[model samples]
Target chain A: MQGVEQGVLDLDEDVNRYLDDSEVTVPETYEEPVTLRHLGTHTAGFESAIDPDVVADWDAIVPLETVLVDQMPPRVRPPGELVGYSNYGAALAGHIVAEAHDTTFEEYVQSEIFEPLNMTHSTFAQPVPDDSPGNIAAGHTRDGDGFQTVDTVYINMRPAGSMTATARDLAAFMRVHLGAGTVDNRRVLQTDTVRVMHDQHHVRHPAVTNWRYGFHEYGHPDAGVLGHSGATVHFSSHLVLVPASDVGIFVNYNSNSSEHPPPGTVIDEILAVCGLQSSSTEPTPTAQPGSRERAETVAGGYSLSSLPQSGPLQVIDVLEHVSVEPAAQNRLRTVTLAGNTRQWVETDPYVYHEVDGNDVLAFEVRDGEVERMYMASEPTGVYQPVPAHERQLVTGSILGVSLAGFGLSLAGWGRQCARQTWKQYRTETDSVTEGEHTE
Target chain B: MTDHSESIHSQQSGHPAEHIESDERTRSLTWLARVAGVTLSTVSLGFVLLLLVVIESGGELTLITRPFLMQVVLTLPYLIGFLTVGTTAGAVLAWWHRYWSRRVRIHHTLLAVLGLGFSWQLVRLGFITL
Candidate 1:
């Protein structure tokens, strides 16, 4: 974005033009080339893959271009088709910025974004650069009935998930974005550029959450809230900027566990303490006529597109299905395999709003069926329809029956062997009895 | 396997026809059932064992980081498919020839039906694009 502000790069220009050592070629299936704009909005047509090419060891980490070029994900969809979150796209954008300035990504961010905002302790360098101030937070995951500290997973895609910073630093960064490109009169970005970045760049629908240049709409489109969430293995953080109120809230968690409330609920608690607009204070949204019919039409299983579809991790898709079921009185309930359920009221033709919360669920319908759905809470990815064969009802039954077959077969063979042994023993006893009679 | 081609000594011993009929399972189907059953059982058991390992070790995110491990995991579906086909063929032969008792025949047919169902799921998931 700084590169764009300086006229060093164009948002609509071919991203490959800026690269010297590597390129993002348009796959043979796709005729449209990807651009920086596409990357920023996460609509670059790359297949959704979560693995960011983590290195086995610190010494194995290479330059960003080497990893990007070697592991460039195949463009499985046309550019601008739909948003599939891409770590590769984010890293590629970072590389383009570095290329524009003739410097490394970590150095460029340290000098430009971090230094200008006075976030002195923040650093993108992994193993945290020796001179970097502040102790890095340790990560933890669930163990048997307890939590255990684990080593942080390292990745070569430094620009995507390698940032290490304190909560204070994150607040300052959010304030800078919310301040419309200034902190105490120190202008890091022009006001117009901030507007362009914070405003909707790629909108799915007016009623649903849309993607700003880098941030995603949070809570609701009308709530004047935008956020970007980050997580790697056992660590998680969320930064929300309520631009209209000039209020920014940042939350960080050292451990990624379901025991903690989601970031939104935490933000809601803070807002309530602050006497700001919480979900309860908001007026109830009325449902449009014919809500029950629309709910029935869209009721089915959906798969998260962010999970890999062509890898061993494909099994994860089966476990991640979300089902929408019709509820009483013009409402719908979404249930996930993970057991998180949310109630939604149909407020528009295919748009639904959360019952108590402001999360928006907007569906794109074609031929009277849901094409895809975007929920404000899950900004990382959208949901696509899961086919009938792959649904749990079908797959689970097959798995159950096959396992039963294996068991019954073993039992049958065991029974046959037992009968033969009994026959042999009885025959031997009869022979022994006849010999005694002869004697 | 103890097939219906009862040994000459057992026949001479005057074992009834029903006794021979009860032991009519073929060596080929027996071997097929063993391979398919064991392979499927191993996978089901491995899933439980892997859950224990993950829970006991906290988590193993490194599995995703290494390409070698991912490549090995990617082959599992195909391995299951290959064994499924073998099981299906064995089941069909067992049913057509009444190769074993009614109980065993019914069990083999059920296994075939389940194998087809699972294979269809694999195809839907694109693990078996062909």
Candidate 2:
């Protein structure tokens, strides 16, 4: 984004112009060339790509070019068609940044962002640099019976999720954003660029979740929150900044065990402790009767656009589960991303509020049809309704055929047993009759 | 002496009649065995279809990240069950053809081919990239 501010790169320019076509050729699935703006905002409709080797082998590190080439997920949908959060897209942006600056992505970020902000502890290096201060937190994951310490899994797409940093370094990084791109006497990003990043640029749907340059919006622009969250196999972290209050909170947990509270809830608690209240007013929306019929349209299954739907990992897409149904008094009952059941009160014709009345859910309609849904608290707010055929065709066939085959085979076995028994009985009677005749 | 000779002749005639009747019964049993083989094969084919659809629709498309090891672990039960069903069905059909009827029918061959093919595909889907 600083590149955009300094005229070193254009946000709306075709990203392919910067990337080496041999190493990274994003298929032009749609006529609209993917722009840097789309990449940063996560509106580029690229499928999620996660190589299985990276998770299992900690030492199996690959170059970013190889990771990009091998795991170049297909552009399944048209560009800007929907907001699908993609790690691959973010990494692609990092690649573009490296290309524009004529240096490696790590070097660029180190010299530009980290050095400028004085975040001495943060480094994108896979093998944590030796000179870095403080011991890197040892990640832990649950074994069969107990937690086992593990090394940080090396991310092949390092730019997307591999950065390691301390809380102090993060505070320094946040201070720059809170200071409107200025920290002390240094300026990493111009105030105009920072304003562009915080301003709502692309919205998945109207009155739904608003997305800034790379940040997710949590409330109205006047009293909104902007931040990003990340998780690895054994580590979870979140960072949230409220520009209105000039305060940012960050939390990083070393274990992936469920015993730890979610990072979102922890941040919320921290904000509450800080006595930072949202200045936005809640709208009391009247309930529309079921006669509207449009309400029923939103009642179906939706899946995170960020989830993979191609290659081996596509199975996650099938398993990704969320459902919305009309509840009592026109309220909506939804299974949240956290797998918890939550009730929502209708806030508008298609907008709904969490029963707690904090999070928002808005359905996007195009041409009188519900096209997508945006939830304020979801990881990737834009959710496409799961096609009915995908749900019914495969599941229904498996269950129906299995049960039918079981009944048929059981009946055949019974018939065979009865016939064998009858034959044996008749043979015994015949032999007895023969003995009587001989006597 | 005449009455004894007549009794011997009647016994000889009765023996041939009994042998013919037994042959008929054996033939009927062979026919029944063949029918059972066909039924088992058809049922097994249905099971194979179900398994294939499941892998196509769910397994291949939705695995999360690089957790292939975990995927294999979770899918082991289904893989084992599939193999068990296919092998058992194939064995029953093969036994009927080789030991009981001593004749292999088209349906029996179909079942063997389908069972083996499905088992191969199932293992591939579970353990490796499909």
For each candidate, give its TM-score against the true structure.
Answer: 0.85, 0.73
Per-residue lDDT value at A298 in model 2: 84
Q: After best superposition, candidate 1 residue A173: deviation in angstroms?
A: 1.7
Q: What overall lDDT goes with each candidate model?
A: 0.75, 0.69
Per-residue error for A265 in candidate 1, Å, reads 2.3
Question: Candidate 2 clash total?
Answer: 8
What are the per-residue Cα lDDT tens digits for candidate 2 across B17-130? 777996787676556554544554454455445546555543332233324444444454354345445545554745664534333444344444444443343332333233
A325-418: candidate 1 lDDT, tens digit per residue? 9988768899977788988877668887787776788888999978898887677778998878678788778767766666666666678889
Compared with the true structure, what per-residue lDDT tens digits does model 2 show for residues A288-328?
A: 66523655778888877876655435445555557788877
Candidate 1, A341: how far from true, in Å? 3.1
RMSD of 2: 10.3
Which ten contiguous residues of candidate 2 chain A have the minimum total lDDT? A49-58
**Clash tally, candidates in order:** 0, 8
Worst 10 residues of 1 chain A by lDDT: A278-287
